[model samples]
Target: MPETGDAAPDFTVPLANGDVDSFTLSERLEDEAPVVLAFFPGAFTGVCTDEMCTFQDRLAAFNDLDATVYGVSRDSPFALNEFRNQNGLEFGLLSDYNKDVIADYDIEMDFADLGVYGVAKRSVFVVNGDVEVTYAWVSDDPGVEPDYDEVEAAVEDAA
Candidate 1:
């Protein structure tokens, strides 16, 4: 897993924001804005929905701090688009359908009972314009959520 002060691993993948587009982490870094990557297990689930909605509600505040937020999931781009539309999310979601990003980030989780494997472990990472991780949070329990205030503070400090 990437720790604070470590360089973030970059990846290019499909972004779902009601419309599909290419999203490149390194490219976003080039904009000199702090990037918040929230890795969720799946879409349309109770916890995932609530977590994403919370981020949506906090979108303006993050924007004011010059931070860009992205939700990362193993769902396909089409499903992610539907999830964004249904939740009225303002930020884009990256599709890690191939499961490569989750593996690269070392947050992969397995739900053996559900027969679901290699899903994200519900993580939040803050990477600054320098491509270094400013904050890192990972949860083994999918039921847990990140502390929004702490994440916001990390972005503020990164800025």
Candidate 2:
């Protein structure tokens, strides 16, 4: 995945916005706002659900830091739409079903042996207003959660 001091790769995907509508990234996500890209293996999986809901619970913290968070996965937009509704997620759930974004970030975890393929590894990247990655964490295990304190500090610093 893109690391700190690296330029964040710009890619737009279908997003299930909190308004219960599908929108393009350019439609709502503020490019100038500090961005938290939360990439996970799948939408409904246990660890993925916890990680996403955790982000939702911390929404105000992100807002206080003037940051916007988006949960990204290779799930279809329709599935993401349902996931957002089911979780009451306040953020966008990006659909990278084509795996283009994951490919670009190079964070794909190989679960082919388990019959999963091209899923994004559990990871987070904090991007500043300049669209440069300020912090990055790619979990060694898919079941592991990210270091929230470190990511929050990065957002604060980038802000």
Candidate 3:
């Protein structure tokens, strides 16, 4: 997985921005504002819903820090579209259905015991304008949610 201070690998995927479209990480990096990627396992679950709603609530704070947040998962763009609408989310959710972006970041989780594999572990990466990771947090237990304070702090520093 990308460590703090390492250059973040870039990828483009379909965005859940109430439309079927694409967003590129590297493209955002060029704009010189910090970007945040929140990697979740899937959509429409209890914990995932709560976590995303929290982001929805604190979106203004993130914008104030000049950080753009994107929630990511292996779900299809269709599913994420509903997830966004149901949660009233203001940020985009990137569809990593092919599992390439998580693999690139080396954060792919194995859930063989649960009969699933290559799903994303709950994690967050704060990538600065320079394409470097200012903060990284990966959870071993999928049920764990990321610390928003830490994430906000990283974005503040990068901004």
Best by the lDDT measure: 1
Candidate 3: segments with Cα more than 4 A from true spot: none
Clashing pairs in 2: none
Residue 145 in candidate 2, Cα distance off native in Å: 0.3
Model 2: lDDT equals: 0.84
What overall lDDT goes with each candidate model?
0.95, 0.84, 0.90
Taking the tens digit of each residue's C-alpha lDDT, what string does model 1 give over 1-159? 999999999999999988899999999888847999999999999999999999999999899998999999999999999999999998999999999899999999999999999999999999999999999999999999999999999999999
lDDT for each residue of candidate 2 in 1-159, tens digit (9 for 90 to 100) = 788899888887877774334544333435546888899999889999999999999889998988889899998888888899999998888888889889989998879789988899999988776677889899869989998888888899988
TM-score of each: 0.98, 0.91, 0.96
Deviation in Å, model 2, residue 54 alpha carbon = 0.6
Q: Please list the residue runs of candidate 1 whose C-alpha ends up more than 4 Å from where it truly belongs after superposition.
A: none
**TM-score winner, 1 or 2:** 1
Clashing pairs in 1: none
